[model samples]
Target: MAKVSINLATGSIQKEEIIVGIDLGTTNSLVAFINPDKNPQVINDTGKGVLVPSVVHFGPAGEITVGNEAREYLVTDPQNTVFSVKRLLGRSYHDIENYKDFFSYKVIDDDSESLVKIKVGDKFYTPIELSSLILKELKARAEHALKTPVNRAVITVPAYFNDSQRQATRDAGKLAGLDVLRIVNEPTAASLAYGIGLNPEETKTIAVYDLGGGTFDVSILQIQNGIFEVLATNGNTFLGGDDFDSAIVDYWIEKNQLNKADIIADNKLAQKLRLKAEEAKRAFAYQSLVNDKIGDIWCTLDRNTFEQLILGKVQETITCCQNALKDAKIEVGQIDEVIMVGGSTRTALVKKMVAEFFGRPVHDEVNPDEVVALGAAIQADVLAGNRSDILLLDVTPLSLGIETMGGLMDVIIPRNSKVPTKAGRQYTTSIDGQVNMKIAVYQGERDLIKENRKLAEFDLKGIPSMPAGFPKVDINFLLNADGILKIQAIELRSGVKQEVEVKPTYGITDDQVEQMLLDSITHAKDDVSQRMLIEARVEGEQMVKQVEGFLRKNSDFVSIAEIADTTKYIDKLNAALTSGDKDAIHKAIDELNEFTRPFAERLMDQAISHAMKGKSIE
Candidate 1:
């Protein structure tokens, strides 16, 4: 890392210092720099001397490629090639189905809860490991290009990535030997990419519509006098251009009458089809129609047809924007400007949709794709004291709550609440002689226990076995600046302190991160990948079984699927239960259940029916 001197009094630019901002994206990863003169540039890591493609490939002969070189392998070596790996980064095997159509290799349930292990050429690597490879390659590119070690950087993640995922991202940065200064939200960073360049004291409200290769986010930000406050943000970490590309592929498949086989059945065909779809999508962004012939089928797709094919998916992306506005409690009309970010936002249809939603045209001053990386660098400047005019106030996207009586979720801190916030819950023993108190932590808005995510569990051990009604414990849940949770429990009577367990769920644990780093270097290639995949698959099955059972038991009220379609996926899952391939199991599990949907309205309807059916004594 290079150090540069700056004049604090006047906020004037000074000498040159090298600080890189890294956008470790799902479908692509890039490193950027802000020179001493405030001239920003994105470093090229390609074979042709450009940005890396964030794709990785493995072969039987210990051969590998990165950047553009590895990207071409999608067309050349389908079975062993991997792309959009960022989708798997910090996500469980259960989350892989959103992009499973594009992954050439298979995913297995690794033993880790937060890890997805890919099996390829008799080997396996967690998405984190693959991410590190890309990050390391980017680091190397930065150092090699600058002829200096690139140790310090800022990384970006989807606005919706939870604390665990964000931590995993930071862990990947450390694995790559980079000092990840901060993990900024992709949309927030893009705001800074432009805000920092403008004169201070100007108040601007921007609604960021970010549709990336593998994730979608909508962020509402308020910038005043250079202070960037993220009012509200929401997104689907699993939704992105990848789905649109798959839609195109599905279009080709359906048009060509190739429904005879599963898309995953032929590695080569899946890879080629994805490539063709991506090309057509890119072309259709400008031209009315894209004449693309690259896979098992040939087709000419007009922009109108392409837009219609992805209308639902696109609506889902816009829904995120709508959700963000609702979370912010701000109306769309109040937004000063609408900014678009990410590679997939280039589509004219996307622009049209956004314009219609906001009832205004989007600001296209900054390139949607590179704005995030640029904003990351700007934040890096702020953290390093290069710029003092800016201050950012961010909020946690999910509510923090604890399980209550009857497995109901009692929320402590609501979503979009400012960080470094504190809340406490006073819990008393329920029975006559309750020895231990179980406080299960959860995230999400659902009042039902099973519907929410179990983050961790705290046990108040070594009680005097006193009467349950007499014993009391106060559990304090505090969220720090980094959005990491810390919990503490104090016994009111005895004054004895119970252990505070800040254990994380749904993402890689700290121990796993440390172990992964060592294993990446020492483990035999094929074995590690195999182990990770198996673990991922099993967990995926677990998720499937739980959600599927819930769906079947309450079939009448589900907004999820038509009865026939729902049963079909369930049958497919049943068929895959015996399959040894963890990836397939995981993929099947995820495809069946996704989104924060309110399932089986009949549950509520049943409650009301029961109440109504009981005749009033009056």
Candidate 2:
């Protein structure tokens, strides 16, 4: 067995083994680590390139392939392939309903506020699960290249990602059998790779312009005393390199006099054109024109035309930079350095525009695609105590959470998170027409709230009565430098709100906090087990209530035999919940969901038909 050691002071695992850094991107993902020479290096196992395409494909026999191997299925089996899953992370059906057609695979539209799920064949998967597959591939690559068992990682996400998206990334890491040490911001990581924050005495303000395959963001950061603080972040998640390629495709279509709808309808032709567009985009770096052909289609584009096509998109990024600077309360002259990150930044137009906007030479010495992972590796090194000169900022002493279902502590602000931070998560009521919700705040490292210290409790009243999961309740935790915690709960639909203040450090001694941390680590396995069982039971109960409510409301739509079958599955789930077996509860829940889906979909179809009886299309 591998040796394990824990730091009593921080309650974190000691870094006796290598901890890799991962840049999980929308179009690609890669892993990096601190080499034996103490320099961060991206891992390229065998002859495979440093970048792995962020794609997953399920075979007919249920076998799954990720990365380069899976990229082939985009044209061959688009329905079975999943791409750009990062966009769906922590998102609900309502969040992505507008752009559902952008995806080739089936993204379930359950008309609920629950997290989005992707359907492949007969199996359902959340974005967290799909992302884990990509991470697993990265982990395997790292281990194969290093000739060691890698299990710890620091993953990087966009600076604009919210708390839910970050949490989803952490969960993806866990599911991939890796201990996610930290979720670092992509801009911060890129800055680290550029050696912008290594000096404690030298302070500088920098602008990081990141334009990746499917997203764009500009972040204003200040580095002082070895601390990297993000002053402001702004970006369009839907705008990126892909849009640039699409412009090329559009140009080609207009030139060839081909129908756009026909091209889209032919998946194979669309993929061919998209791939060719990407090739043409890359070719512009060395030449002024790219004249190519795919079968009968003519792919001819000049550098000037390409630039003109994407001029609007590049201008949009510059506008974001302007807004970021305004929000940071800084002028262009105040920016000491400008760093370029993401593969899209390699374009000459992007580089020129960004440099001109900053009124300074931009830093592009490091590979744009690999900078984030390299910087993350450097951060992992620092966390491993390999760098003594770098000092991390002050952080929260313990995890702060609210009591969720089954008395489980749903952490909002995790332990060791940098203070003066804000985080929030959306929750909903368990019962239909729940007008009030009790928000019980707790602080500790345990999974159960009863085992933690209760900070405060209050009720958020006056919520509008609606069906379960209809109300959007947002709970936010804001912790300041003085250790004062402010918890706010708000119902978005009804405008009902409640707020509470608690000094988390008021009564607890430092030694007591240390003891709690130690206990949490010591009982980590058991605590996880208990937490899992409780969560399963809670899910089972919710499923039962929803099924019962559905049957009561739509009795005329469902057959008697269907109701009896659903009741039978519900009874099985109830028994499983009582048995306190997590696996059994999951299995029962899955069976019921599978059985009920067909009829539920039929009911929905019928309801739509009935509602559209007198309606005419505009």
Candidate 3:
């Protein structure tokens, strides 16, 4: 029998889980949830405030700090602190080469089109890893405030974010141990927070003008029957409130007649001036003029001067708004509402300009910084089936996945995902010189592929031959409103692609699906155990192959005793694989990895030293 929990006071069945809403912004991030009073509220745990700075610091002893605590290290240890990491997500070094100077830390430039990585001390971190740290912090805070273990979430991203960026965000959430239910658009979330489109009869065209700390975007949305559709979006990922603070900094540098080169050279001095400039920008909200000092540096700015200095930057956003409307094929008069989001929109000139352009009063009553997150909470509520007024979304009947190594089902889209959704995950070749991959798709709720119904199978050809794990294959599943699933696989390095379509529910009765789901649940324990054993065997085989290949190619670098020890571990792993014991296989793999890691690092260090000396080792 299924178990249910009842609230003692209300004598009502309580929700089995709470799904929080997260706004993982470039400059700041926050989490929100539906409170017991049936209202969307942002969590403020221990009065640390609603906003968490998206900064990370790595200490010399390998400790890591995130959010407000990490923000303090920006000036003291600029080289080890990472900020504005969202800009690097899914981006190649070439994509941001022009804006490299904007970063205070080291961003590795390997002269390739692959994803960028940030170097902190001796360690390198991908944007996804850094982002996961921030998400983990938000998850901890939400759990503390709600007094519950929060695991699922609906994350909001900019409407302008591309597929790779969206996928990166999903991966980060997964790394942070959150099962992301939906990746909502920032503008849609903002609209929901304002109570728009809650009534089925309401129809409106709205513009969401968002200018946050490190990014800006203007989205034109059409809402009807509780459905929000984005008409057009345009903005620069690198332009936002941070640039406004920069404008003030530049003005102060010019007005004070200070040595520009010297200020730029002094990292601490530069950060202090930037902080003072931010303070002055905030003070301009109520005061006409402000004067401040950071040590020997003088910071003074009048409201008029600050406005003039940033006029061109703000006008650029207006031009983007114009372009968005043009693409949407709507005039300003057609807009029924103008919603302002982002803390930067608190600027007086920004409000005045947006209000005049839309020919409507802007909605700023809701806290601009928390609007996206609040809207996200409302969306989470809708997904939780707590709001009947909102339109119910159609969802997939069963999970869709591809058969991985070991005949295990690797789910790309989980069951009950809302329709018209697209999701993907990356895979790599397990064999050397792999030039093609066979993709077999399946649909069901089981953990093993043999128990699921096969939908279709296809081959992705023309993958460039490379060492195992060198070729990146991205498989995407696009399920439309009509229940048709279109699967596409692409080798990112070679641009080779293949696509196929299948109807997951065609000719399959509701009774069969119900039985399949019931059977999956009934045999869940046994199926999971078998699946784990198969997976462990596959992993052991892969590790054995990789280690053997490494020895064959680089045996000259290692001593005879080291080779003998490595061979012994490989033999033990092979024995475990034949034993059909998952725990034993895992233990062997762990021992092998731990034994090989030291020599691997030594080899890597030697290679780097040789490369730096303009030489290559055979």
Candidate 1 local lDDT, 426-472, one digit each (tens): 67775556767787888753445565567888787765578645777
Q: Write the per-residue lDDT of candidate 3 for residues 1-618, one digit (tens) a residue.
A: 987765443345667678999999889999999877899999888898999999999999989999999999988888999999989997988999999998999886634455776767655567887998999999999988776778788999988877668767876776677767788899999999999878789999999999998888999999988778899999988888889988998888888888889998988888888888888888888999997787766787799999999888899999999999999999999999999999999999999888988888999999999999999998889888888777778988788989998888878887767899899989989888999899999998777899999999999999999997899999999999999999999999999999999999998999998798767756655765686678668767888887887789889888899999999999999999999877677678767877887877788998988778965668
Model 1 accuracy (lDDT, Cα): 0.70
Per-model TM-score versus the true fold: 0.62, 0.79, 0.73
Which residue pairs of candidate 3 clash? none
What TM-score would candidate 1 get against the native? 0.62
Q: What is the per-residue lDDT of model 2 for residues 412-500, given as tens digits with 9 covering 90 to 100? A: 99776887989898899888789999999999877788899999999999999998788999999999999899999999998889999
Candidate 2 collision pairs: none
Off by over 4 Å in 1: 1-17, 46-49, 61-64, 74-82, 92-106, 110-124, 196-204, 224-229, 250-270, 291-298, 391-487, 490-618
List the candidate numbers ranked by lDDT, top first: 2, 3, 1
Task: Give per-residue lDDT, candidate 2, residue 50.
Answer: 97
The CA lDDT of each predicted structure is 0.70, 0.88, 0.87
Off by over 4 Å in 2: 1-15, 394-398, 419-429, 432-618
Looking at model 3, how many pairs of residues clash?
0
What's the lDDT for candidate 3? Answer: 0.87
Deviation in Å, model 2, residue 567 alpha carbon: 9.0
